[model samples]
Target: MQKSLKDLKVYSSSDFPSYLPKLNALYDDLFSGGKGFRSKLIQMVSRHLSLKNEAVYLLAQTIEFIHNASLLHDDLVDRSSLRRNKTTAWLKYTPEYAVLAGDYLLARVMVNLSEFGNIRLIQYTAEMISDLLEGEWIQDSLVGEWNVTLEQLNQVHNLKTASLFKWCLRAPFVAQETYDEDIHQLLDEMGGLLGLLFQRSDDLLDFNVRNYEGKAILGDLKSGYMNSFAAFLLQDCEEALRLKFKKAQSLDEVKLLVTPDLFERRLQEFDQVNQESIDLYLHLMEQLAQALPEKEQGLRDDLIKLPHPLYWRKR
Candidate 1:
């Protein structure tokens, strides 16, 4: 039977060693606020396969652990004051504690996977983690670089963000020992599209466009990071205006500098480009449906509903 998300407990105090109270406390705070989107994605994909429930839970838990670990480290690196409306881990706890907690989660991921005894799954997950670090390194280098291109940001997003999505798509099949190369390749492409659309939509939130979530406006600008939307908005701008754009502290300032007309035009163009990716994803879903066995065809229906919400931010 397919399980509802409520049935899955991806994290609990019992999962960690009780000897270190601080570590547990740090994690309790860290994991409590996340949307758990990636883990849910794993469950969605796994339901189509014939895998055991234990295997599905393992994959879900693994992704959450890796993702939350990245967040722990990311909060420290970004020096952000808040996450999910609560104080960031680095500030709430010591920086050293935050770092140790992040490292511990990653270590636990490997330990859990090793015990699962799937050599291929273990190796692939390790590679994904490596890609995530490489992405972070490249992203850190791009900070304050106002001239960074969308292509460059795409490279980082693919490694850091898309890698997780790709793993979510492929890992369930891998767990079931379905090693069909074609199926994996299509899933890879679809996952990449999903990640790009998601990241771009998130970047839009920085500009407060369709920002239903009320995320802090201009956080990326203030942080010296040029998000994908910023890169797109600045691509055609002159040097002086680009400099002005970087200095924007408020949304009104950003709008004034970019001029409301140009900003709207660029936003439309950005949405159109992302819409092309959405169309491509749907096409890939058609191909995926054909590659999947008849019994798993229902998975395509579930996945097709993702791109619209992911890119459009419609809840």
Candidate 2:
């Protein structure tokens, strides 16, 4: 399965416009750098449901394209100069080209999904695009708004991050003509929960937690941008923790807030809250798995085992 997937990737890369070498390079660069988390999740889920051969490729392609498109736009929004230890698309390519390339990938995702002739899948994808943009706008609006609530943050994450995840599960079932409303609802809840956890974990990467590599430590703090995690932590946290967060206006201020002991305490607190949420979501995932096609229980099992090493996955 992995080999076949890799081959498809090669095909995707090779399909680039011949006259646009720079655009092709940009596509290849971003594609190779990603963690492939969503792709992996979709595969595991599809296998659990015993989805047949031809369908999987379309699902995989749809997801990878959607993910890459979002990243291109995100980097542009963040003005991020780097991603995956390399210059971002907007940084490496001109902003115009980066946006164009992202748009191109999105178009390809649609054309690819059309192979299924699944109108529901196509419609969902269209809605997802709008949701992605809506999420970004909401998040951007909350940038300097220190009072951002967990409810508000999750709502934004649902639109931006979770919607695609919800699509991953639903699209396959929709394709199979076996759409179970109950299971679909459960999966949507699971995806939404997972997105919140995933994004919160991503936010920690920016805090320099566990001496982590990659994400620029204190980057969000420095940017006057409080992330979902920070927003959660700040909500009714101890006075000192709240005060420490409030003091941070930029990266330097964030750097100063993370003394060694505070870092340790911060992580412990995060794990406590994070684990509770993950466990709740995992339960929802298991409930959703009950609706899986009979032959794919193993895939359902994998869903439960997911997000492995639960507590330390973030650290």
Cα TM-score of candidate 1:
0.97
**Model 1 stretches with alpha carbons more than 4 Å out:** 1-6
Worst 10 residues of 1 by lDDT: 1-10
Tens digits of per-residue lDDT, candidate 1, 242-270, equal 78888888998998898899899999999
Q: lDDT per prediction? A: 0.92, 0.73
Write the residue-wise lDDT of candidate 2 on 150-242 in tens digits: 788888989988888777767777767666789778877877767767777778777655435455676776666778767755656566665
TM-scores for every candidate against the unseen true structure:
0.97, 0.86
Candidate 2 lDDT score at position 224 = 64
What is the C-alpha local distance difference test score of candidate 1? 0.92
Specify the highest-TM-score model's number.
Answer: 1
